[model samples]
Target: MNIAIISPGPFSVPPVNGSSVEHDIDEVTKMIDPEHQVTIYTRKCATYPKSSVEENREFIRYAYKGPTPYLQKIIKHIRKHKPDVILVENRPTYVLALKRHFPKIPVFVNMHSHVYGSTAMISKAKMKKVVRLASGFITNSEFLRRHFMRTNHIPGHKIHAVHLGVDVSPYQEAKLHSSIKKLRKQIGLKEDHRILFYAGRLMRGKGVHVLLKAFRHVSEKDPLARLVIVGGTGYGSNRLNPYVKELKRLSEPLGNKVKFVNFVPSVKMPLYYQLGDIVATPSVWKEAFCRVNLEAMASGKPVISTPRGGIKEVVTHQGSGFIIPPKEWSKELPIIWELLWSAPHIRTEMGKQALMRAKQFSWYATAQGYLKVFENAVAKREAGKQPLQKTG
Candidate 1:
């Protein structure tokens, strides 16, 4: 089967920087390649030069750096390819554009989250309608599926929970002591200093500021603890929020104890994970599905996430890691600190458990599940039968 995936995210292919969604695309393509042909459609902002067409590992990438009017060109390209099924990843803008002009093809809208915080640019009703018109729907977690049925008014049958995939091969235990020691030296981290790592957009909705506040509280107790933040200013947009600025200001009092590395490539993330004693996904809102937590778990690092979205589903209390409510970081941090300081062996044991749990969610399984959905859409269309539809 030939498939076309459209995403407004600038890096549709293997994004040079690092993106969980792009990582998903890469892993999924690798798994489905021998049996299917896949093409990815990505957007490029005006300021940056567009990357040339490159094909590797059985997938081709097409980039659009032109103005908004070039969407017609996207439709034309899709029409020419005549793919078996079209999958659009997020971005209600593309959904509105395609639904308005090109609704003839069987398009599936894959929604990763129903987060209504900063990026919830579209109305819930409209998003639900887009899902209704599509051949089928794919979501990252049951939390999002329930949000669709209850809030977006979509039917249960139309929605499928296919959690995002993570690569666990890198974290497989083989005595990575040398690699860990190298990273510690590069980061100026001492042997006794426990590393607490956070990676994601340094934005408010991501709860970075809140995490900073909690880290300060943790610092009061454990001065040797280091907080390492990894993420960029977010895709060429320098528009800084006050909370982000405050985070920068707050990092100062800690001196060199707190480190912020703007952005690291996805390929190099394993080293950072290896350096971290514990990984945190402190999302303010219910994250639709956080790949960061999965990556930490894959790296054999215990995760500390909020009781939001599918985070609790991914990390169990005292098992893979701990799941505390968003504002309860005060209540949670001490316990995490205690785990890191008092129970080093227990943390290592938990990290081992996390790696084992991470393997259960593989790109191969996710890609095969996606293939089944695309095949069903094509089969239904070929049978001259309309997919059964339901509205909230």
Candidate 2:
């Protein structure tokens, strides 16, 4: 099968430290390439290092620079390639572009999350219309799928739920000693201190402020605990928000215990995950899914996440990690403290269990899910065009 994946994001396979959407695109393409031809389309935001390079299997990249007729350019490429299936990552702009340009091309959209909740890209009404136009819709979690149906009136049959994939093989029963020492030395981590890690974009919906508040509670109990936040470039208009500021303030009392690193590439992320004893994601908004949680789990680290959207699917209360009730950090803090104080052994056991569970989710599974969607899209397209026969 020949497949084309379109993304409105800044890069085609993500430069390094990119969003979960970019990571998903990369993983899916790599997984499917062995059995199928795959190509990725991304916005020409800036100059890439190379025009094209074949890394693994059969994968190709087409990037355009500047903002000159992007939709027209994409359409031209589609016409030239005549791919068997086109999978467009669900961004509001791409939805409109596909609706206008690739109407009959059997476009399958991978809906990352509900637009009504946290993503400030499209409004409720617009999102509904986009879902209606898609030939097939996919979401990472059932929560997002239900949100789409409830808000957009989309039928249940129209949506496919495929949870995000992870590579558990590389991390299965792996030693963290080397990775830990490297990351610790790089980030100035202390030998005796226990590290609590948070990985994701330092944005509003990620709940950086909530993390700080909870950190304060955690620090009150274990003063030596260190929180390492990784991501954000600290560049231009998307500068530090109020949440980042609030975190700085909250961490002040704890002195140098809180540390923030901007823009750690995805290649180096596994090390950070290895160094962490626990991973925390306190996102306040409804996330489509959190890829960081999967990485952490695969690295044999227990996770602590607020019950929100797709996060619940990845975290289980006292199973993989603690899934606290929404907005209940005050009640949740003690649980975090108990784990920090009494259960170092449980942390090791749970970390191993987390890695084992993470194995069930893999990129091959993600590719298989998309391939099914593509097959369905082609079948549906053919069925719609079949001429009606007169009844005898």
Candidate 3:
């Protein structure tokens, strides 16, 4: 089978500094069976060349920066070597275009956010056209799958929920004493400091503000606790925006109790994960799926997140981590932080369980799930059967 993947057109593959969706594309391609010739498409970046291959996969990057040119590049390539099935990441409109260009080919549009499924980004009439044309819809989590169905009036059978994965080996490597010591010295942290980590877009919707608000009480209660917030407003974004500026102002009273690490390359994230004694992902809005949970869990650190979207599905509350409701973070955050901070043994045991849980969600598993979907969609199309009819 020849599998062709289209990136959202902004991020480069190998996920040098892109979103988790790109990272998913990279890892899933690497783990996909060697028998299939996987072809990846993404916008070109200085960090990566025009074309490259890793194992059984091949990358054909476009120098064009935006969506239209990116689609043209993909169309040109597909005309040359058409795929068995087409998978477009995080772009619902691309589904309509691909289906229009090659009506016979099966195209699956992946949904990574509520914004994409809702009428906010795409009109209802256009979404109906997408539903009528698309072979299938893929979501990062079952919660997202269900939410999309409700919002878009999509039938359950037309969509599949394939959870994102974490490559645990890299995070496990960060646990080495030498690596830990090196990172500790680099970050100017003492051995006794209880590092609390938060990574994702530094926006209000991501709940960074909520984390900062809760951390004020946490900092006053625990002197040894240090909060380290990671990421910028967007991918490779450096300049602090208003939200980040507010975060800075909020942290002023806490002084050095809080540290903000602006967006670093996706590859170097594990080192920051290693520095955390505990991880916080308190998303105020519905998160389709947050890969940071898996990354933190793989780092052998217990996660502290809210029960928003697919988060509760990923984190085993009190066993692997704590999933307090967003409403209760004000009271629960400090207590949970105190509990984990007071007992190293509790942290160790939960961390072990967390690592065990993380192992189940490997890239290999994610690849297998996607491969099955692609094969089925392709097989169904090849049989000369009509595409799935629009369901509401």
Candidate 4:
């Protein structure tokens, strides 16, 4: 089958920097059946050429003149390629346009999150039209699926929850352990110190402040414990924004206990994970799904995350990692952090379980699942059957 993927305009295909959705798209497209051809439509970037074909897939970058012209170029490409299945990512507004202009093509909207920059300003009427036209909706987690269903008043059958996956080989225990010493040395971390890592955007919604607050309490109890924060202000931002500045202010009294590192490339993430004894993902907002938690688990490290959105589905309490409610992070996070900090045996056991759990979620498996969904949608479309209509 020929597949066309429409990536959001902000990010590039194959994700030179850190884009979880784009990375997933890249992984899944590469792992799809060799016989199938995949083409990704993404915004033009200096990092990538206008059009390139490699890894059994083609990437075409569209210029960002404006929404109308930008989408026109994409429509032209879609018409030229005439893919069997169209996978639109996140932007419902674009899906609306695609469905209106090219109704015969089976289009599936892969919603990465409940909110999208492109569809934020779109009216509810237009959104309903988009939902009605798309063959089906795909969410990364059950939590997101349920949330989308409830919030959008869409039927459960119309949406499918296919969990995002990590490439577990690089994060295998042996590989992670092999690089730990050198990674620690490079970051000026002492061998004896226990590191707690947070490796995503340094923003308030990500609960970096909450993590810092909890870390302060943990540091007071365990003098050897250190917190290492990775990443800059959200995606695409290269500077230490106000949020990072506030985090620095919050970490002032903690002194050497808190270390803030600038953004690390996605490829180098395993080294950072290897340097840490525990991973903390204290996102206060409802994260549709967090790839950081999966990556950490794949690296054989226990994660301490909030039970927000689909996080509980990933991090089970006392199974792979511990999940504390966001509201109770101040009271609960430090205690859990202390527990993992004090007991190396427990942490080691949980780390093993984490690695095992991580194995269950693989990019190849996710790709296969998506293929099944795509085939079903195409078959239904060809049969002149209407999509599963949304009913309250």
Each candidate structure's TM-score, on Cα atoms with residue i matched to residue i, is 0.86, 0.87, 0.94, 0.93
Write the candidate numbers in order of decreasing lDDT: 3, 4, 1, 2
Top of the candidates by TM-score:
3
Give candidate 4's TM-score: 0.93
Candidate 3, run of 10 with poorest lDDT: 380-389
- Tens-digit lDDT track of model 3 for 20-55: 778788888889989999889888889877999887
157-252: candidate 2 lDDT, tens digit per residue: 888898888887565534534556766877878888778888887777887767777777777777678889887733122356676677677778
Model 1 CA deviation exceeding 4 Å by range? 43-68, 96-104, 115-120, 123-128, 173-182, 235-241, 385-392
**Deviation in angstroms for 312 in model 1?**
1.6
Better of 1 and 3 by TM-score: 3
Model 2 RMSD, rounded to 1 decimal: 3.3
Clashing pairs in 4: none
Model 2 has an lDDT value of 0.73
lDDT of each: 0.74, 0.73, 0.85, 0.84
How close is each model in CA RMSD to the real structure?
4.9, 3.3, 3.9, 4.2
Candidate 4 clashes: the total is 0
Hey, what RMSD does candidate 3 come out at? 3.9
TM-score winner, 2 or 4:
4
